[model samples]
Target: MALPSADQTGNMAEMEMQWAVKAMHHAETYMQLLKAVGGKNFKLTPIDDELYSDFKRNFPDLNIAVLNDDDFKTDMAKAKWREFINKYENRVTDFNFGSLLRIDCTGDYSEDNTMFVMRTQFYCIEIARNKEGLNDSHHS
Candidate 1:
């Protein structure tokens, strides 16, 4: 398939890349917080326990320390994630928005390891990472 040119894809300013830069910063900030407070003490919210519980309940196969980009991208995974995220849709702000997530909790985001995911899905995985101290390394 031919790649779409900027013209064919419409104004670049109106593209996801524009907002993606901002989203990257947000993700980085969250990572910084994890480094600062130590992942074990970093909470995504007051109900961190419930969020972590639901995450494990729904995704027993997923590895929170090293995420697979396909986990949420594959059709089968999407359905399960959607159902799990729906439980927090009303409470979590912008829970369904696209956000960048790092594949590994022990490293910084990079071109090869970052993937787009729903904000709440990010929350689920990240909450688990923090709880497990997976991203608590000084360099993370």
Candidate 2:
């Protein structure tokens, strides 16, 4: 996407780009964590391996095709890009923190084809840094 104009005050466009980058980075980290945990048990079909290899081989081309498109300057294009990025962020956050589950039923019934299931639980902690300056600047 085109970068936000230098003088724009409410820079939601740039913010969306920043958020997308952060979300993608978070996804990569999560994938790395999954790989580290699954190690030997991690199963990759030949098709999956080939697809991933191709993605790696042409990542720059794919990224340029997606992100450097000429229509990004238009308001409709920006809005669409924003919507896509928001959806992506919501999906990632759901996978990480939301109560969503998926079951894989890939094989024959006789073979007991319930292959995979996953549950994710996430927690957050916040600490107050200082209340000393709270509301004082407003009064002044």
Clash counts for all predictions: 0, 0
Query: Best candidate per TM-score, number?
Result: 1
Kindly list the per-residue Cα lDDT of model 2 for residues 5-44, writing each as its tens digit.
Answer: 7586576688767765664454445335333543223322
Error of 2 at 125 (Å): 18
RMSD of every candidate to native, in Å, equals 5.6, 22.4
The C-alpha stretches of model 1 lying farther than 4 A from their native spots are 1-12
TM-scores of the models, in the order given: 0.82, 0.24
On residues 48-132, what C-alpha lDDT tens digit does candidate 1 reach at each position? Answer: 8988888888788787878876787789988888888888878888888888888877777788888888888888888887777
lDDT of 1 at 102: 86
Candidate 2 lDDT score relative to the true structure? 0.30
Lowest summed lDDT across 10 adjacent residues in model 2 is found at 121-130
